[model samples]
Target: MSGDFDTIRDASSSDEVQLVRLLEEKIKSLQIEIENLRKELNYYKAEMEKMLSPPLIEAVVLDVLPDGRVLVRSSSGPNLVVNVASHIDQKLIKPGVSVALNQRGSTILEVLPQKEDPIVKTMEIVEKPNVTYSEIGGLEEQIKELREVVELPLKKPEIFREIGVEPPKGVLLYGPPGTGKTMLAKAVATESNAVFIHVVASEFAQKFVGEGARIVRELFEMAKRKAPSIIFIDEIDAIGAKRIDIGTSGEREIQRTLMQLLAELDGFNPLDNVKIIAATNRIDILDPALLRPGRFDRIIEVPLPDFRGRTEIFNIYLKKMKIEDNINLELLSQLSEGFSGADIKNVCVEAAYMAIRDGRNKVTMKDLVDAITKINVKRNNMESMKERREKYS
Candidate 1:
């Protein structure tokens, strides 16, 4: 019995030794595999980092936009923008060109290729009809005031500068609806040789999400680029109105856009040659900040046309139409008291229509009177009045 027990123990000990050796070999193989995997992973990680960290090369502009933005192509067959200043001298740019980029990894246009024929863009200036001081009568006082704000800015920059003053950052034209505030803005831009960016405040009031804010920023930046620019916002009361505590989401967004505009104007250096002029029938609703001294520094009343202004406006429109000798502009102007510039224009159009319907070649006083009566009736219509009131109120 002792011999059998000893033999069994010996056999068991040998089997245990063999099993331990096998397990050790398996562990070693697993370690080898893990080490190999680790090496491969490290290699892949290094390759990925190298690909992502490749240096970006500066590219030269192949072309530019009308706004003077550069469009360039990258070596990787992707298009990119070079950070060349819009004011960079055009003579410096040539095709197959290369430029050193600023530290921002943006390229500056440097070399131009001789073989490349680049596209040259020319700007065409369309002149709006002149609204001379003579064209606007009876508002000599208002015209004189506007001339100081509009005409003097360009005419007397040196005098203004010597006094350590810049032109008004903004001007608000407000009064009865259709009083030619918009027309005046156009005329101001025309007279000043300034670029004009026209926007309606209501457009900002209904924008999608962050678009309004982005558009506002872009507009200011664009205005900066186009220095001596006029940014005219019509219906200014819609977006510039003072905010209330119970604001809707849309209203809040509009307020944010307006606040951004205010900030941009506040930070603006008047030397940049940008001015803001807004027109609204209701200035009472605009934010007080918009009317502050350095911002909307000047508030001009574009009131209903007075008798003489109306007469001049009448002649201006009448001169364009076939009118009978019997048509008296003085009488028409006197009769259209409390009418706006737009109202006068419409009356002329309506009178012409009446004359045409009557198979007449020239518009006469009877046609004018009939048109005026119809216009009055339409103005007195409850629905139309309600709409106008809602618009301005």
Candidate 2:
């Protein structure tokens, strides 16, 4: 009996110890869970506080008073006298500086750093174009001129400085549509290793008043910030057309945009390392102020490819295609008179399509001829329709 009682007591004592250890582990687990929940609760509280805060308004300091008061022009409301926060930097509270205002817009909260306008940010081209000079078959002289005017100034500025001449600020490429004007700009972007900003001139002609001019200003400011940059404005005639006093709001707005462009071109702010390239199909309609000596500096005309140029272009386009030995590129070039580089490329593409349709493995001379014939017929029909429309209108 005594031995059995002792065994039972020992078993009960061991079970009590195990139970105590299990309870302690449970308490530790609960404590850890409480800590995590507290952390989550704090995060939620912080988020709620942020959500409840009033939104601040952007304002510009028009003038600074000797006292703590400032003349601020709120972005949404009229000018008002506001008091600057005591902790805000007084130096940055000067005129023309941006600042955040309180919910009431009666107190300056903090000075804001100047930011690149959103319009300019959208116009920046982050990727370099894949076009190279070798891919451009025609316009050797124009390419050479471009190199001397653009590449030389950028790659070897010492030559220009040594010769005691200011490097050219911009280049103007005028040609018919699809004649490789934009491609040349792309080649420049590829070659110079510069920040290329491609913007269509029409984009600057906004419907709202003052927006167009603002965009132009911001664009130039951005180009300045990203120095050693290239600004390629395609279809420049849209904004650079000759100004007229017709009194229409649209015309007036375009004139304002043009004025801003002129100012940016030769304004008090020097272009320095920034270069401009503009393309247009209608050079005659462009404003003379934009084409004048210092603004464009070099105006190279990109004409249609001549016979030799056409032959070279054909060879370039044909390089990737399997062709018969009897294919006469020279004859095709002769037949494609007045065809632009783009037109030749189209002809080649159409020829390949023809071969595929005929279940042929290679583009033959017959396919090439057929493609040229079909394209010419289509062009003639379009021209006839245009003539009829013009005559009737």
Candidate 3:
């Protein structure tokens, strides 16, 4: 009977131990469920806050008031005196600084960094162009002069310093359309080992007041910051046109941009390591001020290639194509009289396409001749249409 009593107590203790273990597991599961619920609640609260808040708009801080307010120009509305957020650094709220506005445009919620104009930012060439000096066929003389003016100073500044003379500030490349002016500039960019910032002159003529001048200033600032750089302005005749007494707002604006450009060419902050290259097809109408010695220093004319030049260009293009031995480049060059380098390249490409279409592995002389004829007929038709349009207009 005593032994039976001891077994009963032992079983009771085992049952009690099992009950404690289950209770402990229930407490752990409840804690895990509570944590998951807390995360879900927080997520929904954040979403609700985001949906309830008004959107912020971009603004420019025109001035900072002594009373701790800011004079801001909101993107959509007129300028107004707005309150600044207490958490923002007061020193950052200065004139011309960008800022963010609250929904009502009456409060500055954030201090923003000055934004670079997207148009100006994209003008910078981050990657070096693939073109090299050897690849360009014609314009040997022009290339030589360009190298002396632009590349020599960057590569061997000591030469210019020892001579006690300032290096050339800018070079002007003028020629007819379809010439190799722009291509030559790209090759220079590749050889110079410097930053290339290319811009079209017409882009400087902005619609708003003083906007063009601002862009000109910013462009030079960027060039100066990126030392040992090259600024290539294509078709510069658009903004560098001869200044007249037209007295119109648009004309005045263009003149202002031109004046700004002139100042940058010979500015107070010396361009120690920067070079400027400009190209134009209409140099005849450019202002005399822009062509002066200090501004353009050297004026290189890229003329139509001669017969020998045409032959060299043809050889260069043919080397890249699967051309047959029967194709006489000299003869092709003779037939392509008055053709620019671009026109010659077009003919070569057209010939290659023709060969491919006819199920041929190599371009033939007959294919090249047909291509030339097609180009000539098309050119004549375009000229005729242009003449008719001019006459009727």
| C-alpha RMSD by candidate, in order | 15.7, 8.5, 9.9
Model 1 residue 308 lDDT? 87
* Per-prediction TM-score to the true structure, in the order listed: 0.68, 0.70, 0.70
Candidate 3: pairs in clash? none
The alpha-carbon deviation from the true structure for residue 48 of candidate 1, after best TM-score superposition, in angstroms, is 10
Worst 10 contiguous positions by lDDT, candidate 3: 266-275
**CA lDDT of each prediction against the hidden true structure:** 0.72, 0.82, 0.83
**lDDT string, candidate 1, 145-232, tens digits:** 7667766775557778888877787888889887777667766667777776677777766644656675665566555545566788
Give the Cα error of residue 340 in candidate 3, in Å: 0.8
Clash numbers, per candidate = 4, 0, 0
Expressed as tens digits, the lDDT of each residue in 315-381 for candidate 2 is 9999889988899999999898888898888899999999898899799988888888888887788
Candidate 2 — number of clashing residue pairs? 0
Better of 1 and 2 by lDDT: 2
- The local lDDT score (0 to 100) that residue 343 gets in candidate 1 is 81
CA-RMSD of model 1: 15.7
- Clashing pairs in model 1? 94-112, 94-113, 95-113, 228-273
